[model samples]
Target chain A: MTGQSTVLAADVPFPPSVEDFYLPSIVPWGGHDSYWFTKITALLWISVALIIIFFLVTYRKPKLVPTKKQWIAESIYGFVRNNIAVDMLGKRGINFAPYLTTLFVFILIMNFWAIVPFAQISPNSHIAFPAVLAVISYVMFIYIGMKHHGGLKYFKHALIPPAPWFILPLLIPIEFFSTFIVRPFSLAVRLFANMFAGHMLLLVFTLGGFAMLNANVWFAPFSVVSWAMTIALTFLEFLVICLQAYVFTVLTASYVQGALADEH
Target chain B: MGMTAVAYLIAGMLVWGGIGLLVDHWVGTKGIFAGIGAVVGIGGGVYLIVRRLGA
Candidate 1:
């Protein structure tokens, strides 16, 4: 098994690092100086364009009889609208259905890139994308809370739970830290870390094959097993991709619900 | 709800443990304040969880 391909496998960079995530510049055509455009940027724009074009094309004609494309579009929208938004937020969910649907679709597509043939890396593996998404959720919930509760009353509602006066100091700090600090941080890190770890796992298995094959001719069968494990992990990665997207959307909706709730 | 509970627990430890460290630095004690802060923080965490999530 470790035949002529051993020469080609010699360059397989074992133990992939964080540096592997920093892809080269696309605009400058592999130049290191300007990273204004890269695979991550391209994937992001592609996801945006694909979503826009898909929805526009599917909904171009309002058919009572529902074509295949329209059904798909409707199903995607309906899934997020009914299941996530409405289920979490009740009648008020309709107001947020559009934003939540868009968020769900965008994150789903971005995460799907991890298992894609040519595009093996997801843009979400980088913290920037998820961080921005988390910030939006954080700001949106706070804004909604403030609007609903009439000013600083939202802070009182969120931070000052239904508790007595004496132990208020202890509980208050925990609530503040959990709500104000932990929510956004965990939201961003959860998605980023999942994608990052998934990619790293695939890299390790894939490159480990080459490393094993190069170690000894007797290890060729082990290299094949390693490659097999990579294939298995790809399926697991798919499950994670859908799960993370759903989790992100659901959590956002839940946070919105928490904000909009009237005093427990 | 699960995430919220976890956040509460972690936040309790971090907030109190961080305060404990500050106290330790101030009082020139070793890890005593830090340990006490951690214990107090976790206790607060459990109380918060019961009050907020036990329903």
Candidate 2:
């Protein structure tokens, strides 16, 4: 068994870092310089395109009675509407259903890319992507808040937090800092950091298995355990992908609600 | 790796918080905008570390 284990480890190939992961560019713009940006951007667009095409194909003809694709589309829409928006934002949430649905589905697809065989990297794992999404949410909430309430009142509501005047000295500044500044930043970092760490962990176990295999006969059997853990973790990552996407969308709706609320 | 991760998380929170404060000040509204900014900052900071290190 030990002899076979060592041989098995030597035969396996471990996955590498994102920097080392080679994805063929859809259209090769340049070789070395454009490697990260061109390919990654193209893949990102592909994901976006797939999403659009999916919806378009599924809902080309709307009907009271649905087809499989339409059902998928409807189910996805319903999930976001009922589970996230309504649950988090209440009756007012119905208005935000479309935006929340888009956020959830878009993020879910991007995250699912990590588990896909050929496309193993998650777009959200890239800080820039999450940062952009965070900015979008920030703008959406702030704009809605200001648009609904006068800017002066909105700012007052955000900072004041319905507290006493004496406490105002300390509370006001802190409220401003948390509500305006920290919300969006955490919004982006939460998604980015989770995906990044998940990908890195998967990489570590995968590579460790391979490295151990070659180290000695005794190390070979451990590769089986490593591989087993990796498989289990992959399933957990799937849950995370969905959970994170939901969390992001729900939080976005919450922020929007916060902005639109008459009082803090 | 751990230190780098911590630094990135902290930096992200501070940058966002600072931006929030600047935005509030620029808009010329008086209230505890700074307080909101700090809450958002600390929330983001803790969220980053938890998301990364937690399962």
Q: Residue-wise lDDT of candidate 2 within A100-206, one digit each (tens)?
A: 89888889989888888867778888888899999999999988988888877778766564545664554454455556777788889999988887888888788
**What is the Å distance of residue A192 in model 1 from its true position?**
0.3
Docking class of 2: incorrect
Please list the C-alpha lDDT of all candidates, in the order they appear.
0.93, 0.75
For model 1, which pairs clash?
none
The segments of candidate 1 whose C-alpha lies over 4 angstroms from its true place after superposition are: A1-3
- DockQ of the candidate models in sequence: 0.79, 0.05
After superposition, candidate 2 runs with Cα above 4 Å error? A1-30, A36-39, B1-55
Error of 1 at A37 (Å): 0.9
- A129: Cα error in model 2, Å: 0.5
Best by TM-score: 1
Residue A175's lDDT in candidate 1: 86
